[model samples]
Target: MREIIVLSGKGGAGKTSVTAAFAALARDTVLCDLDVDAPDMHILLEPTGTRREPFVSGHLASIRAEACDGCGECAARCRFGAVTRTPDGRYAIVPGHCEGCKTCVVLCPRQAIDFTPRTCGWSAVSDTRFGPLVHARLDPGAENSGRLVALLRGKAKALAKARGLDMILCDGAPGIACPVVSSISGATLAVLVTEPTPSGSHDLTRVAKLCDHFRLPTAVIINKADLNPDEARRIEDFCADTGRPVLGRLPYSPDVVRAMTARLTLPEYGGPLAEAAAELWQAVVTLAAASRPQLQPL
Candidate 1:
């Protein structure tokens, strides 16, 4: 199956908006929101009949107070300062402070610690008007966001295969962090959405380098290209140097905000911005089809 991931080096670059527009235009596709930490595609898609399950990963150490000898060995050995003495002089593991490193669990003289899997978040399979969407939510301050992203992608792939779908459109997280790395690994194409600003130009280079490191074919879309012609030209020059195609240049339009406020995809709203999005999607599909051997899982 062909998988196309939409990403941005920083947030508010219109990444999700573009992804939602692609969802409205693409056919025989499974939609995936890989921004586990902060997913907003559902706001536009308004999914229903979601099948959700707890996402369990990593481990948390809990002290069995009844089995403790009050030696305070675990407390002294924990580097994260997760262990503390209770009011009655008993040692306890602070749930929020614990790093789950298992150092306390291993050093407990009384063998009072119990290490159990942690429920970090939830994953779901839901039905949208366009197709099936596989998305997830990572608990605030939770670790292993990269793992959750991989798990959601696996579910999306399985669902697509079962339904005989040929494409998977993923809305990836911003930045070149672990979650973004997980989102693009083993994908068919990576489409980067960026704006015309100094930070946008800088971050676009960073994310483009990341895709290059993985040998993933990438294309660029300059959102609000008219806002700063010089910076937009700089971004285009960078893309030219890196051999990445500039798919489309979208002008700044308040209609985009109006469409989003109405909770509708650009194509569904129907305007100049929507027309540009449709042309961009066409370029993306053409490039994705011609792109060579997909990046193998890393």
Candidate 2:
């Protein structure tokens, strides 16, 4: 199955809206929202969750107070400074500060420190107005988001395989960080949704470099291209000089926001903006197909 991930170098680049529009148009595809940190695709898809699974990315070690003899070795050995001295002269492990390292468990002279798994987040398989969506919600102030993203991708791939879907359309997170890296790692193609501004140019360069790091084929779609023609031209020129394809340039339209406010995708609006979104979808699908290795006729 082909996995096409929509990403951006920064937030507010209209990645989620475009991904939702593509999901609305694509046939036989599993829609995935890998932005666990701030997943907003559900806002448009209006998914009714059918299956929920706990996503435990890692462990959070804790000290058993009842078993502790107050050796304080674990506290002293913890390099993360996760251990704190309580007012009663006891060393306590902070859940937020714990890095899940087992060093404290081994170094504790009292052998009171035990590692326990913490719930980092949860992923869900939901039935949306469009189709089945694989999405997640990360706990606030949680770490290991990259691992969580990878887990969500795996679940989406599994759902696609089980249903014999042709593709997995993923609404990826913004920026060139770990979560974004995990989201695009094995994607067949990345559709980069960008805007026209100085920050847009800077972030685009960073995100493009990240895509290149994975050697993934990438296409650009400049949202609000008409807002700043000069900046848009610069972005286009950069893509041209770098040999990256610009799939479509969508003009700024208030209709997009209106549709989003109504919790609907652009295509669902069935207007001129919808037509533009449809055209963009076609280009994205064609690019994804072209990038795939063609089978040789026997």
Candidate 3:
């Protein structure tokens, strides 16, 4: 199976929306949202049959109030300074602040601290119109989001393989962050979505470099290309210099916003935006066909 990821340099670059449009247009594909930290792809896909399970990451620290004895000992030992005094004057461990290093747990003179596996968030397998969708939600302040991204990707691949699906369409997290790296690990093709903005141009360059580091085939999609003609030209020039093609461009349109407000895709919105999205999807498919042989799992 071929896995293609839709990524952006930063948030609000229209990565997920473009991904949703692709999902709507692509045939025989499984959907994945690897943006575990801020997953919103399901909003457009409208996933159903969701089965959620806890995603346990590193350990968390808990304090036994009775055993703490208002001890300054645990507080002093905590490197993260997670141990805090409660209103009741007992020592407590802040779940958000604690790094779960277990140093306080190991050194507590009163044996007040407890270390347990952290249920960082929940991962869900769901059904979307495109196919099975693998997605996740991480708790606020949770660490190890890279693992969560990998987990969802693995799940999506497994689902695709089980059903003999041809493609796995993944909506990736914004920026060249840890989760974004994890999202591209096994992708067959990487599509970097950008807008006609200087920041967009800069970020696209950064992400394109990252794709090169992974030796992955990459393409570019310029959204709202007409909004800034000069930046669009710069982006296209950069892509040409880097040997990554600017496969397609979409002009600025308020109908995308209308579709978003109505919880539908561009095609469902039924207009020029949908037609353009179809053309973009064709370009992605053509690129994927040419690059499929290079799509080895990393």
Best by lDDT: 1
Report the lDDT tens digits of candidate 2 across residue range 144-257: 889988988888888888888889999988888888999888789988999999998889889888888787888899999999999999999888877788988989988987
**Each candidate structure's count of clashing pairs:** 0, 0, 0
User: Predictions ranked by TM-score, top down?
Assistant: 1, 3, 2
The alpha-carbon deviation from the true structure for residue 110 of candidate 3, after best TM-score superposition, in angstroms, is 3.6
- Please report, in order, the local distance difference test score of every candidate based on alpha carbons: 0.93, 0.87, 0.87
In angstroms, give how far residue 167 of model 1 lies from its true place.
0.1
lDDT of 1 at 178: 98
lDDT of 1 by residue, 1-298 (tens): 8999999899999999999999999999999999999999999999999999999998999988899878889988888899989987889988888889999888887888999999999999999999999999999999999999999999999999999999999999999999999988889999999999999988998998899888889999999999999999999988877788899899999989999999999999998988899999999999999947343221
The best candidate in terms of TM-score: 1
After the best TM-score superposition of candidate 2, give how far the Cα of residue 183 lies from its true spot, in angstroms: 1.8
lDDT of 2 at 88: 72
After superposition, which runs of candidate 1 have C-alpha atoms over 4 Å from their true positions? 293-298
Off by over 4 Å in 3: 86-89, 292-298
lDDT of 3 by residue, 1-298 (tens): 7889998978999999999998889889988888888889888888988999999999998988778778678788888878888899888888889888898888888887788999999999999887788899999989999999988888887888888888999899999999988888757899999998988988987888788778889889999999999999999988877777788888999998999999998888889989989998998888888844332221
TM-score of each: 0.96, 0.93, 0.94
How much is 107 displaced in model 2, in angstroms?
1.7
